[model samples]
Target: MPLNIDFQQIFLHLFNFIILALGLYLLLYRPVVAFMDKRQAHYEELDRQAAEKDAAAQQKLDAYDARLKAADEEIQRRNADANRQLEAKRQERLQRAQEQADKLVEEARKAAERERAAMLEGAKKDIAEMVVSAAGKLADKEIDPAADRALYDRFLEEAQAAQEDRP
Candidate 1:
């Protein structure tokens, strides 16, 4: 009372301030807080879904890698089989070639032997004819030593000429 303060006016202002604060809390503050909480939950769910998708992608990648490795091993196995087959074919061809060469060599040797036998038979016939001719000439002519030597020389010259004209 001495400082001239009014108690009723102070009480009225205090009551008005409390009402204004309660109205702002109900109309604005409470709705904003609820919207923020809802946004936080939505972001958390999105993060969880992204993590799940990443895990699925990783699993797919692992499966692809395993398939690729299996394919590579299969290719290597097939390649090795092909190489082995090629080697086997090569060995077979080489063996056939060697056998053919041996056969050819044997054939050449047999031909040479046959030719030698034919030559020996021809020489024997020629020698026999020469012996018969010399015996006939000796019986038909006189047995003079000089005449016999001259006849032998003539037969030797004819045999030499026959050999020189041979193919």
Candidate 2:
């Protein structure tokens, strides 16, 4: 009444505003807030599951790495063993070859000595015959068998003495 305003209308409008605010809070704001909370909880659960999966994946990777390292070590060890075996085999083969060569050389030496002995025996027989023929020609007679043997023995002894004196 002081400024030509109606106090009853103003009071009624204020009451209507209060009712509208309460209705909006119950119908729209409350549901929206609940939905946001549920969404946040869902996202948090998803993140936790993802973290668990990552941890499991890392554990599996570590296991694979360990196995791979072990495999590599095993391979190296096997390779070393194989190399040692190969070296041993090579040494054995070399030793066998050397022994074989020595045996062959010794056999050749023995064969040569035997051949030399046989040749010397043949030469002695030939020299004896030649000396006997020459003595028969010089005597100009058919000699007795015992005398021929004695002459041959004397000639061989003289030839051996001459050879020893030479050089």
Candidate 3:
């Protein structure tokens, strides 16, 4: 009314603009926003699944490490047991060898003692026979002090000869 503008035409243009905005909001804008929300949800699900798979892999790694530790401990225990058994066997063999050596030494000492006893007995018999022979020869002659001395010297010579013959 003030600038000679028509009120009916202005009202018509304003109504047309409002209708176009409403149509775009319902058709293009709403569909694009819904598509973006859907894509975001899909990506979130993929991330959650990946986290679960990583947790499972970590659990498997821990299990394998535990198994390896147990295997190493078992190997050490077996080696210790084997070493102990070997040492025990070595000690037993050493003890047996010592016993055998002691037995041999004792037997040798006993044999030497028996031989010495036999030699002493043989020396006693020879001395007794020499004494009897000297007495018989002295009885056949006069036994002066000089003759007694001479007989003693002869007996000493025979005893020395017997000693030389012994082993």
Candidate 4:
């Protein structure tokens, strides 16, 4: 049982461990960890900006859709009003044309009635004059002019009485 240990060997082993740790931190571990942290922070900032931009674009699209819908409704209302006004004007023109046609027909009927009455009156006057002239010719020799005139007047009176008695 000898308690004999090497101090030089122990000191050399401790120095080697410290040198190995420093090399690992400087060449491999610290650089990789720092690069990973920087990449994570960049990706997070990009994701946040993308989300904000998407929300803004969505709001703009919704406002545009609402404006288009309002414009379409306004056009529909204008078309309906125009159709109603056109129909009203058409009806008014048709009614005016019908009224004018009715008036023209009425005027024609009145003209025909007036012409028929005039013809009837003229025919009656011609018949009366012919009867008086024939009676004067028949009594030319047997009666004076004044007496023949009186006789023709009496004949005309009797003729009117006979016509009245007939059915």
Candidate 5:
């Protein structure tokens, strides 16, 4: 409105503002942007490393799990084998014990039978001798050992009758 209010001063102020803007862009803005870009790149690299570490850890864990599973299976197999062996041993022991018991029982039975047969044979011989002595006493004479054996057989009938009368 004043026409002479100093146009040169206005132009100089605009030039100074443009120069200030250029200086700020070159010195502060670009450096700040570059520093921010570098920081972002560093963070990206760290993130990638972290991802790689996580993947490696996961792989190790998987391997450990596989090994544990295999160990468990092996242990189970060994236990089963041991159990089978124990059962077999138990059965074998039982069989041996049974065989020994059977053998002992058979031997005892045979010994008892032999003892019974011997007792019966001795009793028969004693009866025969008693019959001969009794017949000799009844006849009031000494008997010839070999000649009266047939006559002594008659006493066996009387002995059997006496046994039948006993309760």
Candidate 6:
């Protein structure tokens, strides 16, 4: 009671202050804190979903790139196979052409040999007829066909032997 000090009023005022603080904590502070916590959680969830979507998109892009690369490789492989087949066919055709050319050359050589043989036979017959005519004219008599043929054969053999002796 010194200097009009009021202990009861001070106690009452302190009690009123404590009650008000409790009311504020229940009505305003707690709800505000809970609302802030909910908003933060919502934002975090949205960010997580966005990150997941981005990852999925990136995965899809990687898959598409892989497919594109595979397609390019397949195309290259097909082209190589086609080129190889074409080359093989070309080589086969060239070989066939060479064989045909060789066959034609061989036939030509055989034909030339037959022609040479025919020419030699015809020359021998002509020479034999000339010799028979010359002998008949020198002897003033006709020559027998059989004897002329024998003499022609002997001359042909001697001519063949002489040709064989040449280098």
Each model's lDDT comes to 0.90, 0.87, 0.93, 0.83, 0.86, 0.87
- Which residue pairs does candidate 2 place in steric collision? none
Better of 4 and 5 by TM-score: 5
Ranking by TM-score: 5, 2, 1, 4, 3, 6
> In candidate 1, where is summed lDDT lowest over 10 consecutive residues?
158-167
Residue ranges of candidate 6 with Cα displaced over 4 Å? 1-5, 76-80, 119-167
lDDT of 1 at 44: 92
Superposed by TM-score, candidate 4 places the C-alpha of residue 81 at a distance from the truth, in angstroms, of 0.8
Cα lDDT tens digits, model 1, 53-127, are: 999999999999999999999999999999999999999999999999999999999998888788778767886
Off by over 4 Å in 3: 1-57
TM-score of 4: 0.61
What tens digits encode model 6's per-residue C-alpha lDDT throughout 1-167?
A: 88877999999999999999999999999999999999999999999999999999999999999999999999999999999999999999999999999999999999989987987786678668766865766487457788668766776776677556533
> Positional deviation of 10 in candidate 1, in angstroms?
7.1
**What is the Å distance of residue 136 in model 6 from its true position?**
7.9
State candidate 5's TM-score.
0.73
Clashing pairs in 1: none
Stretches off by above 4 angstroms in model 2 are 1-14, 141-167
Task: Give the winner by lDDT.
Answer: 3
How much does each candidate deviate from the true structure in C-alpha RMSD? 3.9, 8.1, 4.7, 8.9, 7.3, 7.8
Runs of candidate 1 with Cα error greater than 4 angstroms are 1-18, 134-167
**Model 6 shows how many backbone clashes?**
0
lDDT of candidate 1?
0.90
Query: TM-score of every model?
Result: 0.69, 0.70, 0.59, 0.61, 0.73, 0.57
User: Would you list the rank order by lDDT, best first?
Assistant: 3, 1, 2, 6, 5, 4
lDDT of 2 by residue, 34-145 (tens): 9999999999999999999999999999999999999999999999999999999999999999999999999999998887787677668767776777666658957688
Q: Provide the global lDDT of candidate 3 against the true structure.
A: 0.93
- Clash counts per candidate, in order, are 0, 0, 0, 0, 0, 0
Q: What is the lDDT of candidate 2?
A: 0.87
Error of 1 at 81 (Å): 1.6
